[model samples]
Target: MAESADASGGGENKSVHVCVAFNVSNSKMPAFCEAACKLLAHAKADKGCRRFDFQREVNWLRSVSNEEHSLFMVRQGWDTADAVEAHVKSPHAQRFDGTLVSESMLVCAPSLSLFGSAMTTSDLAAIAAEARATQGSEAAEPAGTSSRPVSAARSNGSRPSS
Candidate 1:
């Protein structure tokens, strides 16, 4: 599944999302790619993992072929930060490190947006409500909670902007 983001304001049961960029070495490209794909599958199967996948940058140069280094982007999501950390320490990850990290750099950081689910007006309103509810006010309800307002688009057939 595609990676989903955390829109909940309560910060309870927050999904931990990470985007990692990798630079692989020359001779290790094939092996590294194989290991990475395996690790991604393994991560996705782990508990609390919503998504785990890798993407390679497409090259525009058709004739010259400038393949100095390949870039890979990995997206992973978990129910909590600790769960994500545990996923990183999994056996598949350890195998990945042994196979791909000999001469490569891995840069990981949080993501503002993720791959799953499109944005909608109702989604925004629900998030706002959740913020208000958590802040101890009647202004709005919580997003994921049952107290939040349901999406009108679902019943009225309203389409959100792209």
Candidate 2:
């Protein structure tokens, strides 16, 4: 992992950082955490990978993120734009991404934000398009309640917890 540099740093900054949040059910929290451990191992192996943090939020009832159920946030940083892109395309990322981007593990697509000098607005748009493609397009549903099957939001009387 390289040193994280910003405007304060002496050289050009081409770093990128991504923050993603997932709303998971208590039933799947343990499994998700276990998967994250493996993901971290992959991150550690990438020299471009700098920061990786996974945090559980207990006070979601008061959270501004609007994530109801249980929530976990992952923040990762890379030294270069190419590094960020490559990390995501890596097999390890795909292994968990299939589950993370699916309703079986998350109530919905995780809230995501990308920031850095190396990434551009077009890059953000492309990333969003890719996410939509992964989730598959959804037809318009009536207002009120969602007909979509949200596995993590199932009302089995089990409260969502990390």
Candidate 3:
């Protein structure tokens, strides 16, 4: 499993959905599926686990670089990033990785993406402001730029000449 983002902040609970895609050796897919079952079962019992599922790619044979291999996806949702991190570090998940992922069974490291995280505009603005301060002169906008509405200069929808 890939690392979970540090999404905890502002005393607000933010749910996260994690998706991991795997392409594995076709001959080893059965073994991968069997191990994932135990991992999912253990993770489902974890605190703040909202959903967990492991699915096979029915169209895998058409897309896989080698017809002998297959694809799969793991979709999970949790009440917090902490839950996802804990699940990743859990012994069952570790065992699953040890059993299949650490070896040559997988075509590549699993691809992971996390969604549904919420952040305040103010929090984002603060980060932008800090970056601007540290960036010094490079942060300045080009002289031709203006803060005015574009229509003020080009109401006829004609392109400005260079």
Query: Which is better, 1 or 3, measured by lDDT?
Result: 3
Error (Å) of candidate 1 at residue 29 is 1.9
Q: State the C-alpha lDDT per candidate.
A: 0.58, 0.68, 0.70
Best by TM-score: 3
Model 2 Cα lDDT, one tens digit per residue, 1-162: 233334222325767777887777666777788888899888768768889888877564565333345767888887876787788889998987886666377766567666665655676677778768745544344454555565575452223333
TM-scores, all models, native as reference: 0.52, 0.59, 0.62
Clashing pairs in 1: 129-141, 130-142
The best candidate by lDDT is 3
Runs with alpha carbons beyond 4 Å of true place in candidate 2: 1-11, 64-68, 101-103, 117-162
Stretches of candidate 3 off by over 4 Å are 1-13, 60-66, 117-162
Q: Candidate 2 overall Cα lDDT vs. reference?
A: 0.68
The TM-score between candidate 2 and the true structure equals 0.59
TM-score of model 3 (CA atoms):
0.62
- lDDT (Cα, tens digit) per residue for candidate 1, span 1-162: 122344432333465666665654445677777777788778888888887878765666531113455556677767666677677688988787766545453322212233323346776788878777766754354555556465554331111112
Count clashing pairs, candidate 3: 0
Ordered list by TM-score, greatest first: 3, 2, 1
RMSD of 3: 12.3
